[model samples]
Target: MNHNLLLDSIAKHIHLDEEETALFLSFIQPKKVRKKQYLLLEGEVNRFGMFVTSGCLRSYNLDENGFQYIQQFAPEGWWMGDMYSLITQEPGHLYIDALFDSELLLISKTNLERLYKEVPKFNYYFRILAEKSLVSYQTRAMENLRLTAKERYEKFCLRYPTLVDCLSQKQVAAYIGVTPEFLSKMLHSEPELKP
Candidate 1:
């Protein structure tokens, strides 16, 4: 993965001087994970906020019944982390794994704090990010309560068209809160949306 991708991503959100950018890059530790490999597991502290440079990852939790509920999928240029665990330094409920062989840039909580102190603009950027994340979480929760399964599937497609093909139908169904068979029926009924 090109370092420029990380540089470009930061530049899009906030202006960074050369020195600031260098400092930012210095703290980044690049990691590669093969498909089905975990970057983090349940009961582990989420030490790093990860940026996907290539491929995809999913953050999910398994219920008592062993059913997986996916909270988020991070594709190229996206960030993924357990905010609660990162903030509290406690074990997280989610398991984060690569869906495909992936390259990532990780910034540990300690390094992130250092960055926030050294480059105060970074605090503003992260605050904006947190606000957007909260909005998305609230919207998802509302949709789960208010929308029908078919409606949720449609909205999921509209919002994450790339992921529709990138992920398995089963994974998509899990994310949208429906059984695979039900999602199949819904997709079949809407032939235009079926892949």
Candidate 2:
């Protein structure tokens, strides 16, 4: 299961001795999703935080015009869920769905808070994680709105080389705020994208 990978990731910021580690590990359950399945829907409250072990998932918002804007994609070793829904127990603002069949290590919100209480360092870890996520997404948002197609494609490839190969052109284009055909042209013209 390579539990060490998960353990190491968390331990870097938060440490758990033998007893606390056991309790924390006990609540994390294995979850799986078939392709095209929903981890969460826009109107449902999210109760769990998912850590991807394999495959791909995306969060998107459907607009009044029925357009889907891909807000984020979490592949292996990434955390996912609707933060607003999880924290507030309100309806999720985005839909979280499986882009590929997936396996996840999950922790319920109840257990998550319990873990935080049992291990105060975990609270600090979460704070760090939240801040980093916000900053990274803010940078991505700025780039999408301000950069040229070639520049954005270059940045995307540089930043997410792993995910770039897994996603469809249409999906990547949506994330980058461009049409699929436009993304294709950029890919061909840009040496970084061309093999």
Candidate 3:
């Protein structure tokens, strides 16, 4: 495994000693999620909080009508998991799956807590990460309520430029809460809007 990118990733938030870093890195297992694979299923505990190294993932909810509503997308450098399920050991309301073949780093709850004990300030690091998650989802909801469909699609595309290359059109439409056909038209016809 290339330890540089992973170390650089963690160092951006908090520097770890060689020992602590080694222990932390030992806990992060690299895995590949095949295309159309489910990392998490609804009604199951989230065993690992995943970090994307490449490719993309989506978290969605299936309704009684069997319609899937996409909640969030995770691309490279993003974190994806059912935070509630991982924290509480309760069944998750969401299903997390890969949009394409993915290179992921998996960290379990046990090791994360172990890091908190070992590294002292690791809890603070995770807290900040969680806060970002909260704010991002909150902002996304706000944007959905406040912006037009075209506006929301534009914002999503701008925010994740490599997304189209990494994810399918179906997944992109799911992220923006639009049909694939609509996303296609919007992509071609709509003028760009500044964020």
TM-score of each: 0.96, 0.91, 0.87
Give the per-residue lDDT digits (tens) of candidate 3, residues 64-161: 97767788788777788998899898988999998788898888988877877878877777788889878988999899899988878777777788
Model 3 weakest 10-residue run by lDDT: 186-195
Q: Rate residue 87 of model 2 by lDDT.
A: 96
lDDT, each prediction:
0.91, 0.85, 0.81
Model 1 spans > 4 angstroms off: none
lDDT by residue (104-127, candidate 1, tens digit) is 999999999999999999988888
User: Could you tell which candidate, 2 or 3, scores higher by TM-score?
Assistant: 2
Query: Candidate 1: TM-score?
Result: 0.96
Residues forming the 10-long window of minimal summed lDDT in candidate 1: 1-10
By TM-score: ranked, best first:
1, 2, 3
Candidate 3 overall lDDT versus native: 0.81
Q: lDDT (0-100) at residue 116 of candidate 3?
A: 79
As a TM-score, model 2 comes out at: 0.91
Please provide, for model 2 over 95-119, each residue's C-alpha lDDT reduced to its tens digit, 9 standing for 90 to 100: 9999999988889999998888888
Per-candidate RMSD, Å? 1.2, 1.8, 2.6
